[model samples]
Target: MVTFFEASLDKISVHHVGNQSQDELYALSEAPLELKDDVIPGLLMQYFLKPFEKSNEVYHLMHSSDDLALNEVHHFATMAFEDESKFHEASEQIAKHLYKVSTHPNIKGGELYVAYFNRVQIEGNPLDAIGIFKSENKETYLKVYPDKGGFVVDYEQEAININKLDKGVLIFNIEKENGYKVVVLDKTTGGQDAAVYWKDEFLQLKVRNDSFNRTNNTMGIYKNFVTQKLDDEFEMSKADKIDLLNRSMKYFKEKETFDLDEFAEEVISNPEAITSFKNFKNQYEEEFGYPIGDSFEISDNAVKKQARVYKSVLKLDKNFHIYIHGDNKLIEKGFDDDKSMNYYKVYFKEEA
Candidate 1:
């Protein structure tokens, strides 16, 4: 979703925000940090931008009143984007707002970094962006140096892991009226209770229902229908379920556009099952209060990402696991009355 191949770090402010429920205070820097080393900028860019390289979901800043000017993070980001002089001060406001929302007891106090970036690439367009990051977890590292002939182990120092960003959001300069396009990551949140404050309360993000998200969500819904809901309404063996999942993935991979009716006839191929599946998809929209159109363009990136988690394994007790990939018809499930045991038979023309 984002890259920094042509990006440069313009300005950054560091602050310490504490949990409000524990009466911890927030400390802010008066000015932005001076980048003394040229290599330091590159490392900072990696820390800020690398996590978002594989992300496909995009979001926008929003408020309850539907007013863009009232969103704190969006407002501060706008200020910095419009005038470079306001970057440091805007960072201060962002830190304060984060402190105000860190009210959950499980929320840990940590270092917050608000940075202004230039020429950050999103969707192949190099646009200016504002990045807000927080490090809530740390690890101890030991230094080994040469002392005489042998190396000496030095004292331990606690530091943040650049590869493990706990929380982050990158707001692009485009789409000002509909809340600037945003991408986010949060790795250290312990529970949903504490998780909402970061993306929901602090940043106030809404998932952009574009091709990527629509494609991703639709596949997810179908996967749920096959793996979870189908068993309640119909009697389907594990092999049948795997076959259905395989068919769904095949349809997505082979087609450029997705139509509900087409998918049902091609993948499900049963009148009653198709109606049940469509109703299940509709329930998700109604329950979640989101609309998914009946047809839309498919996103290959979303399909690839979703494929990683789709299960193709069928486990039989603790003894064996059948990996169903090519043809489900080749496997057969049977019960032996004499031994009173369940068994599966496999058929293959050749063995690797």
Candidate 2:
């Protein structure tokens, strides 16, 4: 049935060509003739008919039709193409290439590596796919599939092992020079001002003043005086004295010292007290080096109370800087009363 249908169509085309004039034949050579009806004799004459017998125009028409048919076939094949199948096939070929590359003896067992795709537009459409893998030696290979868009090539460093279940996944072998060692730092808790210092192979923390307060609330003793005024007499009632003593004790127990510079700024604004208060202030300076703030209260029924909170400082060697992750938390009771906590695991990477 198919052969008969094709033969009938062919016969109609030939009859149409047999009846055409020389001018019509030339026009048909420039463009394809649109068949408007299925009348066998009409189309054959329009396409195949010619003024001269055994004209070369007949050959040109046949060639033109053949070229058109070939183009249509190619278009249909490409339109029916499946990207998933191409991806699977490309992945298999990449696996084979990786396997060949891994057999070399110089490859390392746990180094991370990547593969890049250099081809574009396969089978008439854009071929943006990549294949990622790990090299156990220069011969053993493991594939890594990213759950994102983009061709599968161009894997690098941490991205190479992001999908691996085992930490021991082979990153690369010693034979390949494309892989480099990577250092990943911990991004858990702490503020950006918090830094790490290396001492005897151990990573120590050197927190900033604000970050220190966020992690340690001991300075709450003097954070209550931002809005209150104190009397000149320095005398306190029984209850006020008790409150002062309790706060003082808590401050000393928590910080063991106070910041005197911060204290003098908030209290004793009189220049005359410089001589006498100098000695008392120096005592705190000797311990904490600086004062963050002072707390004072006004009272109608009794004497007012006051106290001071000091700032903290940390010193470290030159090889390290502070690195805080995006998800850290800062706790604060009041001004100068703050603490930082590491709720998640902290990671440290060696600086190269």
Candidate 3:
């Protein structure tokens, strides 16, 4: 694995200020003595000489001692002093060479990926050059021209809406126009702060301090809905009330054949009977193809009997409204309180 220190040094040397110093300039009046401690020579050694010296194969390939190679290095240094424009161009060329050699297909077990420039806008003529190189693991290296404005990269292509430096993790959102995609990244421990690079601007997304807690709360509600359990203690932890309401509706639909008054009485009086009634209802449905009609009466012998009684039949109401004989208190509780005597109110259509 190439360490960060090696990568940083390579980046610096590529820009070609590896050995030049601001404090002193080499005097042209130097006598033709042994030039052992030359600054430019030291810089050349630091950038290129040392690497080739360590590897004899590379040294021979580059022909380091050749008169042509020495002239090329000297010519590059002279241009750096005489022409600022040529200096920048030479620096860029060196940087490109260094990058090409040092950046392998896989660095530190991660692939190197590049984002090519689809279009460019220059003052006079556009240089259709490719843009920055990025590691598959989110390491970034960019080359920019000082003369032209810097390049702009839109994360829209990556499906990322926002990028945030939260502590040491690169947090981002991968969202579309109205849909949400997931954001995932590796976490670093006690390292340099992570960088968040968006499309030349700060990303627009809120970073929550307790993102884990929020995520847990959301997942809890989802679990509750799946389990059909209501967690009323925590407000946000509760699933949609509609889920519970739907379960209640299903319960009523299955048990609707039972006399409501008897069910209310059994629920309040002998709650165990409610369990038996439920089991019986399940068995009855399994045996019989259709659900039994409402208004079956529980006889004195505990046998079920169909009632033939008729009253003023009402039209079908939107809400579930079943009439069962019960006292005022039971009626006041809307039959929720089970102090009611069981009676059946049957509705039969009159023959036309």
Candidate 4:
């Protein structure tokens, strides 16, 4: 579990891989990211910082090497120190956005580096780009963000966007096979059109998939299954289904991670219901072609957002809540002839 924190940058630099248009390669000295009391910078950090601490995996455009993006960043940054003039203008653009993102009310400070490359080789061609990066570290910090009057604080972690960078790549310190988030922004004809790398990866692992997303999707499917069985098939009492849903939510709130088998054993403890769930899971995977993983990092935000789907209530003057989750057809809405009052006619096989 990663905590939220304010993001601060320790060093920043720019590199200009010279073209025939420019006489010599240039670079910017490593400097601090300092924008005191700026709104845009805070917002910029808030947005960019959200993806930090997600995964350490570095993502790249090239298929040949794992550290291709990492190497390019280092190469360009090193060159920037030689001659700073070539990259000064481009560095300003990168800085403008970084400051904008830092001003977001929720953004906490963290150490980050902004590397600008005037021109870097990509697929045997040179392209102008910016590299936003943060080195790997085990330190965690108290994250404080602006509020209505004051602010709030929490723990924080770090990560960066990789699968999609506008004509660029975001590199992380983590290394895994085909495990990176990559983005490619189109800058042809002087227009900035961004495209995510995972869109065309064609490989499952290469796609921009994460445990949080996977868990949300799986929970959505499970909700649908419950809906089908309860609303359409009438396979169980609505009360039971609602109870199960509530219990499942509690599990998600309490546990940091989810295991399919453990969920079956605890949440859906009945043997027959568990069997039904397993069968449905198999059909679900076959139809969707997306495996419901054995374990997942539970998303509390997603769980909170999905809670509305489980709402069931009978209202009376907005003062009383009568939970009627059983068969609605068994209770008929009507008016009592003598009392002239609204009432319900309930049908049952036996009267207690």
Candidate 5:
């Protein structure tokens, strides 16, 4: 299957790529060096076809079919290719940086592919695209140009396809950890904002800092704790759920690091509850194949991101919040003619 597309990707020609940015490029590149050539092909296939978890960083590129941000990409790409010189300059700078990355001793080099697309039509709309793909287990960087040619791309793979490219750049694999990083320069509306995506230890740190990954992981544990640890004899009031979420997020906000013991002491401070939490955490680690560590840095962004997950609500006389874990099935909204007000009916298994 890849063989059919390989020829198309190979057809795109390489352009002039940058200098000085060479040293800066090292910080941005990440692809493992030792993987077999076949490994990369498989990874690429998975990236294009597999549905990424919502929490994954690459979810937008992998799953988003249309959005304003995506449209902006097409606009920028169109402005870029309009002026042949501008297109060449941007393409050249990218190539130069990539070349530097390839030659760097530490960048266990891998194949790099930069494909130019005038525009890809989606849902009766033409959107330009520049695909900066590294044939490795890394993030795919996308650049969308404004409408130029009216080419409809039914699938994402079609846009990233190499064989159908107007121009391309390929660098052989040298290191697996450092492949090709994408830099998008959009000078379309005089606001020259460039977005760059690179994968490395640093990028992972950034992801951690956002607590994006943490929230996702912690949310899962929280749900399990609620389901398994709390006995049916003990009915969890909305207050209990609120306290749990508030304290959990408070720990992330106030603490410099995550200590499981410290978290239990400060947040889930109740002795019996803490014991139950510890048991749940241990069982979760054993069954789920990952340790809930004693320490980790707290991310404010993550706390904010998980505000909805916490869903702590303040109740009023006639109305009370029906906070849920993003599931519509858990609650239903209705209107009352007797009271002439709206109401929510919560669905949960209550213990007598």
Candidate 6:
């Protein structure tokens, strides 16, 4: 969804943000960092842009109130976008907000880099972006220098690794009225409790209703319906459920677009089951407040990701696990009266 091959770091402001609960002080820089060296800017670009290369979900800034101006990150980023002179001032506000939200006991104080980027390609359009990054963890590096012929090893010092980006968000310059398009990465988010500061507290965001999210939501809701809800209203075997799952995935892989009616007829097949699925889907939207569209363009990336979590195995009383991929009818389950035991008969033409 995003590419940074042509991206460059134009300028950046550096600040030190600390954990608020620990009573640590946040230091603000008076001016933006000077990128005088030619190579330093390129290296900085790699550190900031590499992780976003394959980011699929796009987000937009959000606020609890009706007004978008109240959102701290959105306000500052918009100010900086409108006038480059306000960039440093906006960075200060961003850092201050981060410091205020860093209330978790395990949160670490780190250097905050607020940078202006150029030519970040997203969905094929090259747009300017604003990047807010934090470096939390540091590694000890051994320095070695040559005195004469042999190399002399020096002491170790803590330094941030260029390959690791702790927390970051890229806000594209497009869509000002609807809150800018945003993508975030938080590698150091310890747990669900500490994760809110980066995404929810500092930069309030909501998932965009694009193809990727739509596909993801559709797949998720269907999986829940099949695995959890379907058993309540209908009778099904484990093999039958696995076959249904496989068939749905096969349909997603073969088609470019998804239609509710088509999926219901082709995948669920039974009219009674289709009616139950439709009711469950409607209830899901009302319950979660996440609307799943009946028809949308399918995202291949979402399908690939969903495939990893789909269960396709049938566990039979810890004795044998039946792996069903296709044609569940080929496997038959029956009872034996002589030994009073359950048995399964499998059909095959060739053995692998």
TM-score of each: 0.95, 0.15, 0.15, 0.40, 0.36, 0.92
lDDT of 3 by residue, 115-174 (tens): 111112221222221221222233244444444466654332322111321111111111
Tens digits of per-residue lDDT, candidate 5, 270-296, equal 788888887877886688555646566
Candidate 2 has an lDDT of: 0.26
Give the runs in model 2 whose Cα sits over 4 Å from its true position.
1-201, 211-238, 245-282, 289-352
Looking at candidate 6, the ten consecutive residues that score lowest on lDDT are 188-197
Candidate 2, which ten residues in sequence have the lowest lDDT sum? 10-19
Task: Name the best candidate (by lDDT).
Answer: 1
The TM-score between candidate 5 and the true structure equals 0.36
State in Å the error of residue 148, model 2.
48
Question: Candidate 4: where is the Cα deviation over 4 Å?
Answer: 1-173, 176-179, 182-214, 235-237, 254-262, 295-352
Residues 1-352, candidate 6, lDDT per residue (tens digit)?
8898888888799999998788898999999999888899988988999889889999999898858999999999999898998999999999999998889988889999999998999899999899999999889888889988899998666687899989999999999888899999988556788877788888988889998999988888889999999899888887888989999999999999999999999999999999998998999889967787899999999999899999998888978988889898899978999999988899999999
Which ranges of candidate 5 are over 4 A from the true structure?
1-212, 231-233, 314-319, 322-352
lDDT (tens digit, per residue) of candidate 1 on 1-352: 7878889998888999999899999999988998999998888889889999987899999998999899999899889988889889999999999999999999989999999889999999899999999989988878899999999997665687788888899999999999999999997566889888999899998889899988999999999999899999899999999999999999999999999999999999999999999999999999976798899999999999999998999999998888999788899999999999989999998998
| Residue pairs clashing, model 3 | none
lDDT of 2 by residue, 1-352 (tens): 0011112221100011110222221111212224566773333322221111111100000112334223321222122222433333333332333233332233223322222122222212222212122212223344566656743544343332222211111111111121111111222122222212110011111122332232133223233221122233344222232333343434344442344443344443445443345544345435753442332222211111123332121112454333331212221112233544222232445644
The per-model lDDT (C-alpha) reads 0.92, 0.26, 0.26, 0.48, 0.42, 0.91
lDDT, candidate 6, at 18? 90
